[model samples]
Target: MRYWLLGALMVTAGASANTSLFNLLNTGDRVNPVAMMERVETDHPGYIADFELDVQDGELRYEFDVINADENTLTELTFRATDGTLILQRNSKLEADDHDELEAVKLLDRKQLRFSELVRMASEQHEGKLMGAQLEHDLGISYLEFKMVDENGKRKHAFDIQKLKPLPMLQWER
Candidate 1:
């Protein structure tokens, strides 16, 4: 009963959609997201292509997807929020079939907007608890993708990497 309430609060109490995640997760006392991200980068040689900080079933966690171009591999790592301990790691080789995605990730270096800027721009007209973000592309057009949740459930907010304008929202399920 307590867990359910805690989960719901964590879900809905994100201080609106445009706010920074440093304020959304309220992790100042429990975890240091920057340090956690640094730890992930140090242990794995790659750039974080995707990231999320969320509470699921009452457990706080950090999820990161690292893309290593040299090794042509994509790695997913989850860390416990309380102590920044590695909880899980999944690695998969980026095959010839994944060339498009690999190239899209490489294009992130050309983005003119910062992550926080993209988040605020994506949420300016929409409202949802910001969950995570990723660098993605469709039909050769690259964008920064964000995951958000509200009473209506999870939805994606994307911004064009070149224009820095909000893209259409796409509804998705758990």
Candidate 2:
């Protein structure tokens, strides 16, 4: 009887622990929010707000807000790549005069190439000097960014490719 009670208690504790949001966020095999944001910035070179992640009903989601150059707040929703599903979403407004502009150029359009294609092109263009490349799609637009080390080994170059449209085809003029 004592063994049975102990086992029952353990099971109950495990169930409750799994349901706890903080515990799940800390223990899950997910990327750290700060590190993820840094990577996003390194890859895209844009301003981002802090975010939180949670698992709900077996799906992982993320929520955050981004401040545009114009200081407008744009809510961001991200789902976990481990399982393709809606993880979480955040919607909020920015205060007036909070905008900051960034330099991101549009390279290709949605109808011209797929996400994978952009990554491939960027990677191939950089070739042996290429360090890494990543692709991000937000607000129905895709951005292909890459990083590479300079010849002097002291500087790193990050490229941001955005504005992929369909009408007049635009190709990367390497």
Candidate 3:
């Protein structure tokens, strides 16, 4: 009987947490996550690998994990809940990839087009909902890989990072 009562209380508490989050969304205390992501991408340009909407320092905020265009770095960006103002931007290095690709990216100049700019061009031409993106060097060529969702499911877009030109869709060997 004690075990059963404890389990019931736990479930009730879980439901209350969900209700509070829902109420916050409905009452305009927080912005929609999807819209927030879109705005962030438009301004910063990176793959959003994760997101969290929670209270920080007693104030609500949205946190996002961004894999930058270089594909060798990760950035954590936190934004205010009420106005979508960026509160913080933190960066970290990624682990090494294939030797050849790693060497190629390292050898390339830093004057190439910005990652956000490449994404904007690809989005304009592809006409789909931008899902995520990353920079990669496949077979000694550096490219920006973007994933998009449309009526036909997901598709990949690869663009030349140096020239800022779109490349053919990669056919992955499944």
Candidate 4:
């Protein structure tokens, strides 16, 4: 029941290793990631468990794992990043005991910064493109993780938005 890292959980579920941050725009009109997230959350109506913006199947995509405590299920949704079109959806039923995930969501709810606010702050940092963003927890503490790439190179960073702190820099083995 304890998650060592979100990326680990993802890998076990057959997620790709090509998670390095990159430009989401590819041959179509520029799609705003924040807008895609908002629209996906609205259409799916669940607590975000994991969210990612990365290139998948040779195209940019926004992938989400949304948890519905009421139904005790987690839905994985993938949308085309260039046009905000739903490309894939899969729902996995959760164990009855795992409904406690609401508690994890509440932990993030108590944070000082709202998700959108923190995302913008992360996007504006150091002239890099924000490739992915998600809430990650460790030992009951929750924070937002941002995967980015800039003139330097790919970077993975954790921001304690709850405390309004910057770059706690997590060491995820890639």
Residue by residue across 10-127, what tens digits does model 4's lDDT show? 7654322332333233235757877776676678756675677756567777887777766777888988877788889998896654444445555555653345566677567645
| C-alpha lDDT (0 to 100) for residue 140 of candidate 4 | 58
**What does the lDDT read for residue 135 in candidate 4?**
69
- Strongest candidate by TM-score: 4
Write one digit per residue (lDDT tens) for candidate 1, span 1-174: 999999888766643333444344553455655566667766787667777976667677889888887888989899888888888899999777656556656665455333444555666676655578777778767777777666555567677766767766543454
Instruction: Decide which is better by lDDT, 2 or 4.
Output: 4
Steric clash pairs (candidate 4): none
Lowest summed lDDT window (length 10), candidate 4? 15-24
Kindly list the per-residue Cα lDDT of model 2 for residues 85-112, writing each as its tens digit. Answer: 4455555565433321122212233233
Cα-based TM-score, every candidate: 0.60, 0.33, 0.52, 0.69
- When 1 and 4 are scored with lDDT, the better candidate is 1
When summed lDDT is taken over every stretch of 10 residues in candidate 3, the lowest stretch is: 99-108
Ranking by lDDT: 1, 4, 3, 2
Each model's C-alpha lDDT? 0.68, 0.41, 0.62, 0.64
Question: How many clashes show up per model?
Answer: 0, 12, 0, 0
lDDT of 1 at 7: 86
